[model samples]
Each structure stands twice: as C-alpha cells, then as structure tokens.
Target: MNSSFSIGIPSGRNSSACGYCSPPGERSQGESSYQVAGFDAVQLTCQTYQGMIDRGWRRSGTWCYKPDLRASCCPQYTIRLDALQFKPSKSQRKVLNRWNRYVLEGEPDDAAASSQKSRSGKSSTEFVLPIAVHASEISNLSDESPTHRFEVTLEPSTFTEEKFTLYKKYQSTIHNDHKNSSAGFKRFLVESPLKDEPIPYPQTPPPYLPRQYGSYHQLYRIDGKLMAMAVLDILPTCVSSVYFMYDIDWEDHSLGKLSAMREVSLAREIHEAGVDNMLYLYMGFYIHSCPKMKYKGDYSPSFLADPETYEWFPLESCRPSLDTFRYACFSHPSHSSDEVITDEPDYLQVPLSSDDEKEIRMLVASGKRNFVVSLSESPYWQYDEIQRECLPCIHGLGIDLSKGVIFKI
Candidate 1:
C-alpha cells in the first residue's frame, strides 16, 4: 500500500508492425501485432511480478504487457519450460560442451564434443546440470587452467560504455539498425524497476552465483573481451529471460539458444538449492505461427498459458490446435475459433493504513492512483464491437494483479 510493493499504470491496447513475416516499408491489410492493456510499472516485487507473468504478462524494462492472441497476425502465447524436467538434446549438449571445452581447454572441440555424448560428458557421470552449465566459468574451475579465461558476471542492470558498444555492434550487425542510440538501448535493456530480493538459497551461494531476485545483465567475456550479454529477471519462481545479444562474430556458436539453456540451469540451481517453487524458465511469448519463434517449443515438457483461462497446457498437446488456427485455445480445443473477450473495469484502491488513507483521500481523491483506464469506458465498447482486438488484459492478468496495481494513465 505504501509504494514499496508494486505500482503500475495501465496502457491501453496498442498495435505495432509485426516482427515476423512483415516486410519493411509495406502495409498489408489485417497484418499488425497487438497487445492488450499494459502496465507501465514504476516498481514491483519479485513475487508480485512472478504472479503477473504466470497470468500471461511479460515485461520489457518497466513496461509489462500481454499479447492479444485473437487478433494479432502472430498470436503470442506465454510459454515456460519446466527446468527440472528438461533434457538437453544432442545438439544442445554439444553447444554447451563445446563452449565449456573451449573455455577450460582453450580450443574448440567440435569433433570431440560430438563423440562424447554420454550423460553430460563432464567429470561426473551423475549429469548435474547446474555444475555442467557453470563448468566453464572461472568460479567453478580448479587450479588446472586453460589458455582463455571465460568469465560470466552477474550484476544489476546499468549502463556502461563497453555494454553500449556491444549493443551498438549487435544492433548494426544483426538488426541492421546502425543508428541505435545509447538512450534507446538504455530504455530497452538497461532500465528496470525490479527491486533485488535475495534468492531463498538454503545455503548462501558462491559469490559468482546470483544471490538476488531482480533484473540483471549476465555478461559473457572470453579472455577479458566482452562477447555476449543476456538481460534477465531473476524472480522468486523463474528466471524470466528479457533479451539476449551476442557479437555477430560468435553467431555460429548459437549463443541465443545457449543463453536459454544457461537460464534453465540457473533456475535448476536455485531449485536444487532448496527453493521448491523455482522450477520454471519463463521464455517470453511463443508465437507458433512464426517459424523463427516456434523453436521455443523444442524445449520439451514445456507449457503454453491459455489466453482466456490462464491455465497451463503441455506444448505438444496444444500444437494440433495451434496448427489449425492462429489463435488456438488448447483448454477447449473444440472452441478453436478466434474470439475477443471483454473484461470489466480493473481498478481498486491499494489498501492503506486507515489514518493515512483518510488523509490522502482528503488531499486528492485520486491520490497516487488515477490513470488506469477501464475497458468499459471506451465509446466503442458501448456499441458492442470486438474486431481487430485481442482479449482484454484484465482477463489475461486476472483481478488480483488488476486491483493490486496502481492505475497509471
């Protein structure tokens, strides 16, 4: 109630140029990305944000939004991987082992890595994922050393000249956005409002291991040269991946997919360390219609959040429905037809101390929370129309987060 927990202002439904299959400088009818009510948050606790995500919300820096699956050309369904159940594919293991070998032995062992395919191929046969994932990092190494020092640093999100340079180069090389400015980079990656809360590790983890639940920039450096970075949210229940970028020179290594694997390991380490609730790796949106985005389902035993019910369904079980339509409802596959849902007003006063609440109300009736727009207030809603819009965010985020968040205009 006192601004220490969570504070979010609703941002109404909006549209953007679709990321997949939408060619530049071209406008096709009914081809655009849409998001339901979003929250431009000032701050949020790890637990509250975790709940927000489970209900289908995802955040970029400080802006949290849920996709409108029914109308968007590529309906984005929230997906997650169960870290405890994840089994690395042969190719995936090769990537990790190859990277680890290069760091520990200072050479790419592509052939050797491919040959040793038994049970993680590490020093232990038990196949400990947490250990295998960090084997290449300096923290886990012994006196026996390699030529290159592979260092992975976990620190709170902030701006720096080196990180900015890497960002600029990645943008220009991969995205062809040579003019990406530092301010824009900061807004998209560096700026975050998640407060750091210590991970509930049964025993305090090593210094190199992250000890907090908050937004972080996980930097990957080889021999002191910054090569890659993964923007992450270390929350109470999952390691929510925000974004990942690597130097174009290292694209062959598949750092993007490798980063996802490492994130799962991070969650596993926390879970194996005794945090029972920490079992998932929250991969952002799963757009099944897009080829580039569909690989997220490869992380088997994964689940997709039903847009209407907020229930989790196995990705494989939902694939049939997804293949049949752009917006598929796995919970009720018989009703696969796309349909927009209307949600009621999602506004409530944050409970406050009786005296404080009275004083604040007297000074400003809308004090500290007045901007959240209710869907019912829209003139179009009165006329009973639901075209080209996704499900209202109130339904996606549900009433708990709706009332808990302070409405921002």
Candidate 2:
C-alpha cells in the first residue's frame, strides 16, 4: 500500500560550487549555486515524490532540494521527452546500432561497420524501440556466435560486492575518485526514500520489465561481467533518470548514449504494456548555458520547465529567452529585466539574534502529519515577519503542491 504522507525534516538552505561551470578545487565567486530550501527525507510515496519534482525539487539519496535558479550561476531547467514522439537522430541511431553490432556481430571490419543497419537491413524511421533495443539479445539462437553476450537486468538498489567493485573502478577511472567507500556509494546511489508502489498494469509485465514503480538499478553485463549501471526511479507518469555509471573499457561502445536510448525504450514499453501515462522520460536538469548539458535539448520535442510558472515549454522556443537571461520565463517571447524573480531578504548569519542564545528554554510545538495548509490563510500572518519566510516557499512550490506535502518542522 502507498503511504499517505511524505516525511522530511527541513534543512533550511545550502550553497555550493557550481558544477556546470566551476573547475575542480576552484570555487569561483561568481559561479556558485544556492538552494532555497532542502530536506532530509525519511520516506515518500511515488505520487508525492512526483508532485515534489513537478514543483522543481530534486533528490540526491535521501536529501531533496529546490534550486534557487534566479540567484544561481546556472539555472537548471527540468527536461522531459515524449518517448512516443521521440525520433532518434542519425548520430543517436548510429550510437545504438554500433553498440548492438558490437554485441551481436562481434568486431565488424571497417567496411561492414559502416553498414550498421545489417542487423535486419530495415532502416524505416517508424520503428518500435522495445524491438530495436532487444534485437541483439536474441543472437544466441543464430548460427553465428556473438562477440559479446549482453544482458540488462533490473534489481533493487542494494549494496552488493560486485556492484561496489564496478562503482569503485568507475569512480577511479571516470571521476578520478579513488577515496570512495562502499557506505558512501550506497548513500549516493543505492539508498532511496521512495516507497515501491504496484504499477497499475492491466496485465502482469514480462519478467524482464518492472511490475512496480520505484527505485531500481538497471545493471548492464557483458559476457557475465558488469559493464554499466543506471540508477532510475520508475514514477507514476515518467521514468526519472537519476545517475548512470559504466566501465571506461566499454567507452568505445557509446554506453552512455546506449543507456539513454534503452531508458527511452523502457518508458515506451511500459506505456504500451498497460499504463497510459508512463511514456515520458525525465532527463534531469537541463542547464542551457553549459555546452555539455545542452545535449539533452538535442532530443526532438523535449520540454523545459519554467522556473517561475512550473509550466513546460518546447525546448526550441525557450532557447532565446534562456540565452538572454540567467533565469528564463517560458511564457514570454524574449527576456527582459522584469523576468528576473528576485527580492531576497537581508539574511543574518548564525549565531542569529542575541535572544536566540538566551537562557529561556524554548517550548516544543508541532502539527499533525500530512497536513494541508492553504494560501488563503495568508491574512492571519499578513502583519508578521513570519509571513516573509513562509510566503516565499509557498510561491516557490505553488499553492497546490505546497499543500500536498507534509512539512515537518
């Protein structure tokens, strides 16, 4: 059963070096990121988590935060693609076809490698992704043996010795992090606060597919050895991609691009199986100014979430506004000074006011769990300073999503 509440302890605010523009060990004064508010979530149901993301919140392990886009060095716009409408580009198709060829046909000669569509020789634009992605896996029954035996399996996000070994190596080779530990790995990728909920598929899914929506580790293995892993959250309306790590040895196979295509295919397959709303693939945080991050916009028919309105706009249409301003408003045609949303209160750092350190013992106060408070109650706190702190969060979350979540003081 799904829980009625999403539980979390408010962790006021935080600031850090900007990942998009800043170099390692150099925290640029101008390139810093600030989050408005955050939480150490204990647990959340898929529906409530979905609502949280719609309000521009993202989670890393058990910690969730909403980016202060107006003030941040780089604005992160949440992006999604309609798997049904998605048309893979020539480069994307090449990436997938090459990987599949390497898997089923072994290392092809230079001449044979050029003809990637030799798997079936049908290059029709109208193709089913589930079929395309699964084609290479069936070569075992063929007369010719494959170069690599590949298997992609879905398992719960748990700490396994084998996974940790691959993760450690990936960190050392790809990220240059040799100091990573197993516990830290579990905290970042394995542990999740989202509760598993049965996906309402009319019929049970095949063993290879998910029957429930929750956090999962999609493991990619070749010849019985782990090659890659993708951390994913199968949500109510979308497949939320969290993180992907792979062995650098397989870099030539374009595993990063291959993983994304497989994920999009998974979304499509899930939608066709029974669920109507499961066809969208949520590729987290599209930062336009960052050249590496802009590749997500290359996917046709993608949408970027407006920071202010929480509305989705076509990625192409939003590019001009994004180019003109740090924070973009999708509702407008071009950017202007009025589009910037900022009026930050003069914040005093701790140890706060003199009264805070006084001997007067504070009394414990609390509210019921999963409570709903409306913006209409604004009048009650209108004349107080508390309104300043409270109203901004309400505005950030929007009225409906603010009420839908349980705020633990």
Candidate 3:
C-alpha cells in the first residue's frame, strides 16, 4: 500500500458540477502539508492547491480527501473496492471485450451496438495492463508475509486529434430509438440556460486547461482511435463525475460502466494506502421521474443528498420522498443531523373540465364523494418513477402536487 497522492479542490463550471465528467492536471505549490503514517504531504495549501500528482480523480463508494471547498459544491468522491473482491457484471464484461476487440482488430465496427445484444455470455481475453499507480508511495499490505508483488507505471493512453473528430461523427450515429435519447439532453446543456437568457458555453471545445483548473482527461483508444474519454477533477474530499461520452457504436461495449469500474478500483487502492475518509461516487442528481436517470440508483450502498439537510440519506430511506415533483435535501453522516427539508413549487393536480366538475358534484350528492390528492400528499409517490412511467399522461393539469386540490362548486 502506498500513501502517495495529492489533494486539492477544483472550481468553476466544470463537468464535476453537473455529473458529466471531472477536472484534469496536476500542479504543486508551497502550502501546508498534512502528514499521516506511511505518507507525508509535500504541498498542502489551505488557500491554494497545486500538486504534481496527475492521476485522474476516481469516483466510487469512498474518497480519501473529499475537499471542503464551497466553489466545488460537488467534489469528486472515490469508490474504494477490494479489487480482488470485484466480480464484473455481464454488461461490464461485454464492454471490456469491446475495447479489447477494438484493440485486436482495426476500426470499422461502428455499427456494433445494434448487434451487441447477441454478443453476450462469453468471456473475452482478459485485459492485463501494468498497474499504473500515480500516488507517491506503494508498500506491502501485510506485515510478516511474503513480499506482495506489483508493477507501477503510467497507464498507457491513446488520445489523439483524429479520435476527437471520430467522436463528433459518431455522436449522431446511433439507433433512432436512442437517437433522441441523451442527445436531447446534450442539446439542452449546450442550448438551455438557468434563465431565458443563455450564457455562452465554450463555442469550441476549450483547450485542455489542466493547470488552470487542476483536472485530468483520459481518452481510451482502440487502434489509435479514441473510443471514450473521461475528464476528472481531484477534489479534497470526493471525485465528482463531470461528463462521460462514448462512441454510440461502442455502447454495447459498456464503456461507460467500465470507466466507472476503473475509477472505483483506483479509489479503493488509494483509500487502502491511507486516504481514509474518501468514499462515494457523487452521481449528480437523480431525477426519479427521468427513466434515463434511474440507472444511477443501481449503485449499491448509495445515498441521495437530502435537499433540506445537505446530508446524504440512504436511497432506501429516501425512496418515498423522490415521488413528488419537489423535494428538500436531507442529512448524511457526512452532513449535519439537524438539517430540515423545505418544500419547492410542485405540480400535483388532475385537470377538471366544467362537465367533470358537475359530475363530481353529482357524485358527491350521490354519496360517491370525489377527492383529489396531490402526489406529495400521498407520501408514497416517487417523482422520478412517476415521471418515467407516467409523464405527459399527467401533464397539462395545473397540478400543484405540493398544494391543496381545488374542489369544483
């Protein structure tokens, strides 16, 4: 185990803020250094954070030094796994194979995602790369045991300009079903603003500013062509997800999950070496109403940040609250316990036609009383799931699920 790593907080409107990707780079400056057994910090500055350590921040169950900075509200957290304890899921294996196959054979399998469903169940060649440990120290885990053997090197990377061009081309190259999928969201990210007035985003992909922001970017390539890229920012506490993009042709390969898996492994390795408090993969916001966003909940041992408390609440405990359109943040062990949840504006109502109102009156007189209940009042409704299963279905109803239901005269 090696207790060698840098610490810092990333700032600005980076991907880490919105759960897209992470920050990049490493720079070291004179600062207060924190020390623990087996490791010593060289550059620790409370006011400024710069370190030469350039490992892209990893996100998962736990991160060692989740930074305490306000600008980086959502710091990248780390997921530490007992690597030996990990068993790849079916989808995970498929993705690993896809990357390997690409490495073995040349390009031209751009339409593979369509047929990926049929390519499951078999184990592909195992990817055995040198253990590229970036942290400063690596020591044997057990005392009085045979020397544990491991190799540390920079993980080979294959990012190039040609791949970036290819990625843009493949962006629109998916099945019609999924064409309108994440693309719509990407359009929103590029087009939509917090208000009607749009703030101009980087017109051209900004030059990789690793130093200015203390972020890392890694591009996974097969045969010299970029297949996927992850931009990360190493924060003091957690490794926040910025954005992840993969070639639509490679979706079946599950590059997205694989990248996440790698991050988990990295985080665990570092935590074992001594970044004790590093835990958790902050998967941004989970809109239960959005079917696409539900996958985020699949992560085990996951908790949602209580809107009211800014604390992390286990998904199990918070499941009931996600039903309504509005919610407040709760509390987490990482957060204070006295936090309270506040109500936000919500739409929870059923539309009523004049005739429907009259019929309701008749029903009331006939002893078939009519009542309207807001989703928030139900206490059992989850906004994310409802939105996924029933949307526009409940759309035009001036419904304020958080407010009282209107009764017809």
Instruction: Identify the runs in model 1 with alpha carbons over 4 angstroms from their true place.
Output: 22-30, 108-126, 338-395
lDDT by residue (tens digit), candidate 2, 241-296: 99999999988777878888899889988998889988788889998768778888
Lowest summed-lDDT stretch of 10 residues in model 1? 356-365
Poorest 10 consecutive residues of model 3 by lDDT? 31-40
lDDT by residue for model 3 (162-243), tens: 5445445555564223243334433322221111111122333222211111234455554344666664443333344545
Collision count of model 2: 0
- Candidate rank order under lDDT: 1, 2, 3
Count residue pairs with overlapping backbones in model 3.
73
Deviating ranges (above 4 Å) for candidate 3 = 1-160, 174-213, 328-409
Specify the poorest-scoring 10-residue window by lDDT in model 2: 355-364
Between which residue pairs do clashes occur in model 2? none
- 2 or 3: which has the higher lDDT? 2
- Which segments of candidate 2 are over 4 A away from where they belong? 22-29, 109-112, 116-126, 138-145, 333-395
Residue 157's lDDT in candidate 3? 22
RMSD in Å for model 1: 6.2
